[model samples]
Target chain A: MPQRYAYLGPQGTFTEAAMRSFPGADEAEHLPYATVPAALDALRRAEVDLAVVALENSVEGSVPTTLDELATGEPLQIVGEAHLPVSFALLVRPGTDLGDIKTVASHPHAQPQCRRWLAENVPHAEWRAATSNAEAAQHVADGHYDAALAGSFAAARYGLSVLAEDIHDVADAVTRFIALRRPGTPPPPTGTDRTTVVAFIGEDHPGALLEILTEFSMRGINLTLIQSRPTGAGLGSYLFWIELEGHVDDARVGEALMGLRRVCADVRFVGSYPRADQVRPEIRRGTHDQDFTEAAAWLASVRSGHA
Target chain B: MPQRYAYLGPQGTFTEAAMRSFPGADEAEHLPYATVPAALDALRRAEVDLAVVALENSVEGSVPTTLDELATGEPLQIVGEAHLPVSFALLVRPGTDLGDIKTVASHPHAQPQCRRWLAENVPHAEWRAATSNAEAAQHVADGHYDAALAGSFAAARYGLSVLAEDIHDVADAVTRFIALRRPGTPPPPTGTDRTTVVAFIGEDHPGALLEILTEFSMRGINLTLIQSRPTGAGLGSYLFWIELEGHVDDARVGEALMGLRRVCADVRFVGSYPRADQVRPEIRRGTHDQDFTEAAAWLASVRSGHA
Candidate 1:
């Protein structure tokens, strides 16, 4: 039996595009779930070998729900990430003209990216939300909606025509997607790897957030993203979704995680995987693995009362 | 002549209270400005010796407008800060009862804090915005509004009766206010001083923010607050308002600033003022000032072939 790959889809979506970008995805059995939670849940229930979900989009920004789900739920390890430059296309039935469009359907996130074009072209159109842009295209194909804002590639899959291509107010929008599997030892350090962790600030620790950032900073790790969200535990406690440069196996990164574990109320190691951009960390002097190892040795000698 | 102190006030407001907390406020001439910008501009124009404005609040969070004003405009140096516990009160005409109130007034920020209380007590009342809570009380005294949510102390100043006091949904809400003056020598290092700076990310630098945090982190300096705001320069460029634990004169902090200045496109030193809470940073073992000094000396010795 081939490995199963689950994604948020109805045949064609940005998520499916992201999933296909992965190695051996064509050889793997493709399973489409109606929702992101459904896809991840299937993976959690051992129904799928792996799950792919959108983590951050340049235009819509970070998906808070996805981050929260990954950070708080039963552990899943991120094996890798993929970046796709996103551009929307208006999909409609072949006979439908821009003037004939009365209602535009798309995922809530996709609609705003083309709101201006829609206003000028389809002045009479009202926006309808769908779980995925592919689902919107599916609806358009079934005569449930006049048009949809989706990827142009989705048009052929849904038997729809590209009414308008490259429909976006902002150019060069990119979405970063992550692939996850059952918690396991992460992929080996690639020198350009990225490690992720969620730090729950301890109660009554006023500067706990600073302490969390300091752990990575002191190790010369560059935190690519820091999204602070309420822990849902109390009156204003926070949990940070921190993504940083370096693999979990790196000496400095291991030390940083240990430091975070020591300070934060709870530190959850998500995983370490190769960065999609493959940009290597700019390791500062005295923060390299050898530096940390030497520093540890120096401390041990000092503790042993050696000069 | 007494030193002139400009504050965002019409008198008897929270800002006035914050301004009065200063050392020579009572001895100095108090000048009330119509708006926060007006108050700071007065200081900039050399019309006042100093200015005080709200920086952050536990209830409303950081005052973005005030922060942006100080960060982007002509530079002002913070010399002091005060944290005042905020609670609102309902003020009305002397003969009026709680039931007589039809419309309530308060600053927009203050109104939300007391929204639940107002809904429970004055369910029929409508909320009106005021420049300041004291102005709301003055409006109540002038019969412009049926009731005003303000500081209880404002009742005595505006000749209004307090119908209810300590009105807030959340308890222990504190607003932090900063005192500013023309750029000059900063106050000598207090062990618990806080340094503020604004760092503009360079045009092409990807992880400039991480580099900024690393500078502080590598020096064992704790960043008490990190507020990222758009530079308004372009579609995605950002500027960060970073407040960290240490004085400008501290060897570690100076080094951190120097490191930041080297990496960031531009680094603006807002000020180094005594922290309102006076919380000293936890200096890690190898990051203390003497450690940095010793490391520099060792590096120099090794470079000169003396190691």
Candidate 2:
């Protein structure tokens, strides 16, 4: 039996494209969800063996819904990752001219990505928000709107004509997607891997964050992203979402996690998985594991009175 | 002559409510801009002396557009701030029943804040996005929609009756608004103050961020928020937005700023202003200035051979 894989969709979404790019995704039964939470819920309910969702957009940073969902409830671990270069195309129904466009629709995230292009080309068009880019294209195809800003895949799937291609304000926009599964052993360290964790401070005090960073810094782990989201307890309380360059299975990485668990009020290990981007040679330069091994050996010798 | 102030609005939006709460707002000529960038642009063009924009919400975190606008272009300094507790009311035409509601409209931010209430009360209603909460109320008053989720102030302004009150999922939701003006001397330290800065890393090397945090950690500064946003330079590059507990006028804060400037590729001082929330006594317990002064005095005595 084919494994069931869920993605954020009405089909033709950038998320579906990301799901397709995942290894072995072709052998899985594709399921479409109306929202991020819905898809993650399906995975939680065991309706799907795996779920894929867009975690971060290079242009927009992290997706808040996905981040919040991952942070709460029974733990979900990212098992794999994928990157899709994003390019929006203006989709219109057959024979709809630029002059006939009164309202342009797309997901709120997509709207701002093409702000400059829309302002320059369709200055008078009113903006409408959709649940997803593919839904926007569907609306246009269903004659609810004059045009939509969506991916080329969405235009093709929805049977719409592309009035404009590569409409994003930034030329090289990319979005990173992650494959998630029930908390389990993370994929084995692939030499070039990334670990994500959320650290909640014990108290709102000076140097609390410093203590957390010391674990990673002393171990020579480079952080790729650090974001603070309110803990919802009140103002000034936050949970730091941190992504660093190392796999949890690595000795140094394991040590850092152990140290963080000791200091943090709570620590949620999101995942340690192979990174989607091509590994830069610089990321693999140092082996903090070797340093840890040597230091442990020296400490043991000193403890045994060997000077 | 009265000064002119611009805020995100047509009028009666939560932003206007925040602006009204500012000191001397009644004496100033208030102008409403359709969006955050529009209001900031008005201030930039000298059409308004100051712009009041919502910077972050306790529930949603930072408003990316406001952060991005402040990050780019001619330097803008946050001179003051205000906090408004957010609560939404279901507004409808006088005689409309809850069951008669077919579509609910509000700004995108407002919709999510009341998600639980909407899901439980009107689960089948379609969601519509409006430019502002006030505009949503206006739509309902004009019979375009059956109801709107907006502040009670908007309900009164738009002549709609509240069908439900305090409908936000979280009762304590609060938004932090900042008053921005052209690059200028920040308000003098108020004993209880906050400093916001953006630090751009000099390079993407391991431990780069650790070095940046050291300046604050060594100075005993407490960071309130730390977020990383893409620098628009492409993948893997980011600018760190940091909020710490100290005024720029403080000796320790000045030292940290100097240290950051030396270590970071660039440092933008967003502002040092009084915090809207009450200051915790613990934040005032230690003055790093005294520490710096004592260290300097001790070093001088040793260097002069007086020890």
Candidate 3:
């Protein structure tokens, strides 16, 4: 059966770029929505078989709207994850000199990626907000702009020339995307794997949070990230977002999570997935210098529980 | 010495409403920034002695910008929390009929609260995004739109008339605001209190989440709410936002938090403040209604766990 997937798109959205990495692309249908919530709705109503949504960007934090929908909407299992290495470009109408431009337009997320370049080179240009990077390119085509900070794909798709390539401050700017479906048994692990989960608990008092962390630590389990949102139930209560190393079926993993349940008033398991490969040539072979010192230090500390 | 303060302002913003509740209001020197990050930066640079920022809203989840800043920036202590009830109105030009309004403009957060009302009453109107509610009101005053959805205070401030009051589908809508400052000894707690904390960890696994929750349940500590965000690390770690009853000094709380620290790799205590009275009127000598039901349920549940 053909699978229909919805993403934030006109084309060239980092989400669109990530969604392209899905396996068996020929059999999957693709659709674009203006906002994350709209994409989730289409998935909820069975309008689509799968939804590829941008969960987080390396420079920015989690996309809250997507996270909120996941927290409150019907349970959806995250069947797959992708880490798309993002490289940004400054796109402009052909023959327009960079110095002649007086304004730059792009989505909020893209603006930050190009901040340093804009600050140093085009500091005085007005920064305008558009719905998406692709939309920003379309705006450049539809009207006059000094230029736009967008993706390489967006520039090509809109037929705009890349005035400057890879203008982002970080060479390894990547976005992590997730594919969600109605809850089902996780597909058999193919070599490498990762799992995701969500939970709600108290935030106030002294020992409440520590108790949850100790369970994994005691068993040598590692946690990836933890996020929270207000439950609108006054103070002291929150909706917690958590991810840890290993699969749910791993003996120690199951034991540790069950232990967390005993201490948290309420806990929910979102889903587990395969950790995306990090050494793809497209991601690692860019012209940028390969400096992993800071990343290595941070990861080592985290792996050692000292971070 | 007069303290420096920051609030979401331009006047008529819900943040302004929340900031009004702070102590030393008359003596504090105030600065208004267009966004939460701007204000948070002012605090981080020590340009301001304190900042009052909106963390969450009843209709929306955690403000991602606020949580992200707290997660990444210099250490900040959550000194207090407050709940400000939000009631919205539909304001229009003096002579415009409600049916004739073609567009409704407002800050993005205000859109959800008025969604149902707008859907049913003015289904065809397009929604415009504005910088703030007061700005939306000013837009209407300038006749850019036939109407706008805004707070009554905004309308009054901008000299617009309310075409309809309490137009939000949820009557008791409210926002949770957090008062933040550099780490300092909070004034001693009065009897009524709550504590908030954020936890970050380095693993991404399934039951790994439950392990963290068990700490609170075993000690009979009642949790209020939990929310999570990715920490922008490649390891897939999360920053968990949690709330719970009791204060830092309580024996049970101290023990529970100690237990949790063993589980979470990194944890920061965001705040512990007097649990402001919940959203229901303290003395609504009237028939049993929805607010009564909600408030009663909240109080009963907390009292049950404390017992």
Candidate 4:
């Protein structure tokens, strides 16, 4: 049987495009889920071999549902990641004209991306929401709505016309999606990788976060992203979500995690996976696998007090 | 003449409620805008003396619209903040029964907050979007929809009956709203205060952030919130939003800001304002005005090489 993979769908959504871009995905059996949690739950239940869900967007910092779900329940390991450049087109029925477009439909996330274009070109249209951009196009195709803001692929798949192309407010919008599997050993470090973790402060005290950062700073680790989400206990309580450069297999990263565990109430390891960004700075001159091995040998020799 | 104020509305929305809670708000002229940017733009244009906008929600983290507006264009300073406990109620036309409700209308934000309740109680209801929660109730009252998820105030304002009460998914959900005025001197320190600033890393060096945090860690500053937003230029670039204890008037905080200015490409000060959380641990044991004054005098005496 072909390996089963799940993605948020009703087909032709950006997520489906991302899943299709994965290696060997064309040969895999694809399953569609109505929501992010549903797809993740299917993976957890072993209904599929892998799952893909959007984690963050360049325009919208993080997807709250994805973040909250990953923070709780049975832990899921992120095995890989994909970056998709997003561009939305104004989709409408074949004979629909600009003046005939009265109600614009799309997923809530898609609306804001084309706010400027909508305001400038079609200022009088009423905004309507749908489950997905493809669903929005499907509605337009079915005459449920006059127009929609969706992917070009969605327009093609749903048999809708591209009334206007590349209408997103930002030209370089990108969304980062993660591939997840049931908790297990992460992929081997690829020299260019990112490790994600959630840290709960041991106590609400002044300088608590400083201590957490100190561990990584002293080890020469670089943070790619950091965000704080409320713990749901109260207004002031929060859990820090951090993404840093390095893999758990790296000695410096392993030491930092150990130090964090000692200082935090609990540290939830999301996973270490190859970073999605294609452009990255060259690895630091002095820090790599061979350098760490040499340093470890030097420390061992000095411990005998015979250097 | 009364001072004019603007908030996200068509009236009866939570933003309006938060605006009304501001001191002396009743005496001010209230203007309702259809969106957050509209209200802030009105303030920038001098159409309003102040603007009130939702900043963060306990469950949703930061509002991207508000954060991006604050980070760009002509800067607006946050003068005050309000904490409103959010509780959604199901509003329906008089004599409408639960089984009779086939469609539920609400603002997108309200819909998600009651997702669990709706899924459990009214599993078959089709969700519809409205301009605002109050507007949702208004539609239901006008016989356009069967029910809405809105605040109790909205139900009363729209002359609708509450069919179900307190339907929010999280019991402790609260939204933090900030009062903004044209860039000016911030309000004086309240002994308990927070200073917010946005920092752009000068160079994408390995430990650029560590250098920025060191300035605060050495001074024992406690960070209340921290988030990174893309600069919109491309994928890897980001602007860090930071909220830390101490007013800008406080010596340590002022010094930290100065230090950040030296290291960062640019630092934008959002404002120094009193926090919204009602219960707070007494400001750190000895970091108040008296201690700072005494320490200054002691340093002067010791500089003479005599005590």
| TM-score of each candidate structure, all chains considered together | 0.52, 0.50, 0.46, 0.50
Estimate the lDDT of model 3: 0.72
Q: Could you tell me which 10 consecutive residues in candidate 1 chain A have the lowest summed lDDT?
A: A298-307
Backbone clashes in model 3: 74
Among the numbered candidates, top lDDT falls to 1
- Candidate 3 residue-wise lDDT, B28-57, digit = tens: 887888888888878888999888888888
lDDT per residue, candidate 3, A1-307, as tens digits?
7889888887878788788787755678889988887887888888987788988888887888877778777767787889977667888988888787888999988887888889898778899998888888888987756677787888778889998886778888788899877666665644355656666775465755666776666556567777887766888677777877666655445545655554455565667677786321221111111222332343333223244
State which candidate, 1 or 4, has the greater DockQ. 1
Better of 2 and 3 by lDDT: 2
What lDDT score goes with residue B277 in model 2? 85
Off by over 4 Å in 2: A1-307, B281-287
- lDDT tens digits by residue: candidate 4, A1-307: 8999999998989999899888779999999999999999999899999999999999988998888888766778787899888688899989888988889998999888888989998889999999999899898888889998888888779888998987878888999999988877777878788988888864588877877887676556898888888877777677888989978777667646655654566677788888877434344433455555654443333222222
Q: Number of the top candidate by TM-score?
A: 1
Largest DockQ belongs to which candidate? 1
What is candidate 2's lDDT per residue for A57-147, written digit by digit as tens?
A: 9898999988888876667889899988878889999788898999999999998788988889999999999988899999999999999
Greater lDDT among 3 and 4 belongs to: 4
Clashing pairs in 2: none
Superposed by TM-score, candidate 2 places the C-alpha of residue B138 at a distance from the truth, in angstroms, of 1.2
Would candidate 1 be rated incorrect, acceptable, medium or high by CAPRI criteria? Answer: incorrect
Where is the poorest 10-residue window by lDDT in model 4 chain A? A298-307
